[model samples]
Target: MLELQCAVRRDMLGLADGDSSAYVVPDSLPPRARLGIYRNTATGALLTALRLSYPAIRSLVGPEFFVGAARRFIEHCPPPSAWLDAYGATFPDFLARMPESASLAYLPDAARFEWAVNVVLHAPDAKPLDLGRLAELEPAELGHIRFAPHPAVQLIQSAFPVDAIWRAVLTRDDSALAAINLAEGPVWLCVRRTTSAVAIDRLAEGQWHFTAALLAGCPLHAALDQATDAAAHVWLATLLASGYFTEANLEGQVSNLPSGDPAT
Candidate 1:
């Protein structure tokens, strides 16, 4: 049974090896016809999920073009796991390699932005920081502070105004899409899930660097300097409002970061 299932999957994905005759075929359908049906159905299902995962890509390339390229992309980079939401993480980079995408350089970044949105939507819910607890800390304790990034947080920086392009696609506003200049950025963005839904926000240069450093395990004091170098820092009250950092640690541990951590 296992071998037959493997054979069916191999044939469906067009990755069958030689000795196709070795697998026993059902009497009702010819082998080639059955294989073709399986292949179409499997690829069609993948294409639908990919389109849903990347609506911006579909909008930019149109239905026919997106489907053709996505079919080819799936052939080259099939999903590594059955979890579809986590799939296609590498698709934006795959788009960058396509000759058709050369003329539309922002397409890859826009795909990445869309992918980030999808990821955040499926991320585990996270508690926000308790500003009251943070405010009580002595000034000297700031140096030892470690911030815990929310699981839903994702940071992105792009050479093009992909954020604008993504927003236009979401709204289906053709005029807005047309007005977005490919060279308008270097845009910095952060994706985070709110209690009700996911949200993306443009970030200042300093804010991005600061968050990036914290997200990478940099301590509060040094992250402050890093953020202040590129942008201004107003400190914890303002930081908590962004919903990026979920907890503040002073002595190497979370005191308590409940899902319902009270807001100030």
Candidate 2:
């Protein structure tokens, strides 16, 4: 039974030629024809999943082009699990390698931005941080505080103006799309789910680094050290207010800061 299932899946994904002998079918319905129906249905479902996850890509390339690209991607990388939400995670990399997409230099980044948005939207919910807890900590203890990043948060850095491209394409704002300057330097983005919807915000390089460090479970002082900009404290306050973290913990016994501590 396991072998039969594997054979059916391979056939459906076009990974192998149809093996009619593997299945029992009525005389009126050829076994190969029955397999074709299953294959088509499976392909359509996968295509729908990709379209939903990458609407910006579809809009940017048009339906026909998007279909061809998605089909090729599906053929190369079939879904690894039954959960479709996690599918297409590597599609951005695939697009980056596709010869046809080579002309659209920013397409891969745009797809990556979209995937981040998709991931945030589908991530498990996390409790918002209780801001009142911060006031209880002594000043000396602040440096040892470790913030737990919200599960729904995702960070992306792109050389292209992917944020602008995604916004314009998804919203169908032709003028905004045309106004985009591809050479407008790189962008660091924070993608997370808010109370209402997914929010995508561009952050300065310093803030991006600081937030990334915090998200990686670094202590506040350590993360602050990475914030080259003078506004590190301000950025921390803003992130706290935005519910970027779920909890904060002092790394060790709260005591006087060590002489080597960045805070000192």
Candidate 3:
């Protein structure tokens, strides 16, 4: 019975992709519909998960194409975990491989940006770093410091204006999408949750360098050195105002930070 249950779990999850013709008539269901139930349920769950993760993409592709591509994608890459949130990690790659249009090359990057936004919305929350404590740190000790950004913060860089694309679809103004030139390439963006709303900020060239540096665990001075001179202060102010970036020391101590664990 234990082995039968394990086989049922594996086959239903599509782990038995190679061949399971021999087991299709197992006594799980009436012989007439033995494996049909598993097939329907598994496919339905996969489609639902793909839709949840890529609603914008689904909208872009219309229901028919979206369903077709989703079915194909699921066959190649089954969900990795039982957790729904963990599904759809490979969707962007699957889209990028489609030989549709050179001009539509940006679609996959847009999908990736959307996925990152979803992660930011669901990430755990942490209190902002204490400005006073940071001010007292000696310059030499800065390198040893490792600060944690808000778990709800996500940074994404794309070779397309994915930020603009995301906004066009989500905004009320339908004409906003008409203004987009697919020829335009590249955008760096930050997605973070603040005041109970998830917002996406498109970063300028200089801002991208600065934020990327900070995210890479660089020290303040080092990150500043890497930033465009004019953007240094602006980036610092933005980071602080966003309420991201918790000091490494205060991480485990939930008492030190506000809203230690965030909602999914």
Ranking by TM-score: 2, 1, 3
User: After superposing candidate 2, which stretches have Cα over 4 Å from the reference?
Assistant: 136-139, 250-264
lDDT by residue (152-247, candidate 2, tens digit) is 999999999998998898788999999999998999999999999888898999899999999998998887776798999998889988988877
lDDT of 3 by residue, 1-264 (tens): 676666666667666642444545556565326665767788898899888888888777778988988888887887766887768877889888866523467778888988997888667766776666655556676544545677788888887778887788867357888888776867778888887688888878788778777766665666776677585777777786667677543323433322333321
Clashing pairs in 1: none
Over the stretch 48-110, how does candidate 1's per-residue lDDT look in tens digits? 889889998898898998988898888988777778778788999999999987988788888
Q: Each candidate's lDDT (Cα)?
A: 0.78, 0.87, 0.72
Ranking by lDDT: 2, 1, 3
After superposing candidate 3 on the true structure, give the runs of residues whose Cα lies further than 4 Å from its correct spot: 17-32, 100-103, 249-264
TM-score to native of every candidate shown: 0.85, 0.89, 0.82
Model 3 quality (TM-score): 0.82
- Which residue ranges in model 1 land beyond 4 Å of their true spot? 1-5, 17-21, 132-139, 229-232, 249-264
